[model samples]
Target: MINLFHFVLILTLIVVVISVAKIKDLLSAVILFAVYNLIMSLLWQQMRAPDVAITEAALGAGVTTVLLVAAISKTGRLEK
Candidate 1:
């Protein structure tokens, strides 16, 4: 049986993924992508992979999000 916390995390991941794809603003999508990564890190921790979780949190949510945001700042935030 799936625990409530895990189920909620999975559901949040799904929602964030969809939101990232559907969002039109580049900044907003990047933020949602960061959220997705954070949730994925939590799920990885729940699955007993601390290393993977740490990597995801640091690289995916931290570095990648900052890079994308910086790129968006240079390129502009709108999709088109």
Candidate 2:
């Protein structure tokens, strides 16, 4: 059962990662990247690496997402 959850999480991450890459909307892509980072943090935790998970969550999901949003707001939503 636990392993099933892990599989599903990984599958969802893969789909989200693909969506992030294929998206033309900058804002949407940033959001998806943030979600991907969050999922990665969870995966790291599950793998027994709490330190890495915390770092991933803080930098990838938190600070990076904030920075991306600020940059996007300064520019535009759609990609050229």
Candidate 3:
């Protein structure tokens, strides 16, 4: 059961990564990347690494998402 959950999470992460890479819209990619980070944090939590999970959630998912959105708003939302 745990293995299945882990597999699904990893598979979802891979799919999100591929989508982010393929996406031409910068905003969409950023959003997907944020979600990927969230999943990673969740995985860390499940693995009993609370410290890593907290860091990943705060930095990777939270701050990074905010910064990316701010940058995108200042520049452009879509890629040329």
Candidate 4:
């Protein structure tokens, strides 16, 4: 069986990717990307890999989002 987490993860990934692609607003896209990372981290935990999940939760959901938001703020709100 694929399980609930796997199904949820796949669904979340699809939503995230679609949102990222369709959204014109940079901030919203970045936020969705962060959420995607969090979902992926949970999926990793479901697969029984604590270390990789921790790294993804920290790096992907934490640092990457901060950096991207900072970069976007610095650059400007308007997508250029």
Q: Which candidate is the best by lDDT?
A: 2
Q: Over the stretch 1-80, how does candidate 1's per-residue lDDT look in tens digits?
A: 68999999999999999999998988889989999999999999999999999999999999999999889888877988
Report lDDT per candidate. Answer: 0.93, 0.96, 0.95, 0.90
Tens digits of lDDT, candidate 4, 6-60: 8978898998989988888999999999999998899889889999999999999
Scored by Cα lDDT, where does model 4 land?
A: 0.90
Better of 3 and 4 by TM-score: 3
- Identify the superior model by TM-score, candidate 1 or candidate 4: 1
Clashing pairs in 1: none
Candidate 2: tens digits of C-alpha lDDT, residues 1-80:
46898999999999999999999999999999999999999999999999999999999999999999999999999999
**Runs with alpha carbons beyond 4 Å of true place in candidate 2:** none
RMSD of each: 0.7, 1.6, 1.5, 1.2
Candidate ranking (lDDT, best to worst): 2, 3, 1, 4
User: Backbone collision count in every prediction?
Assistant: 0, 0, 0, 0
- Candidate 4 residue-pair clash tally: 0
> Residue 38 CA error for candidate 1 (Å)?
0.5
TM value for model 1: 0.96
Identify the runs in model 3 with alpha carbons over 4 angstroms from their true place. none
- lDDT, candidate 3, 1-80, per-residue tens: 56989999999999999999999999999999999999999999999999999999999999999999999999988888
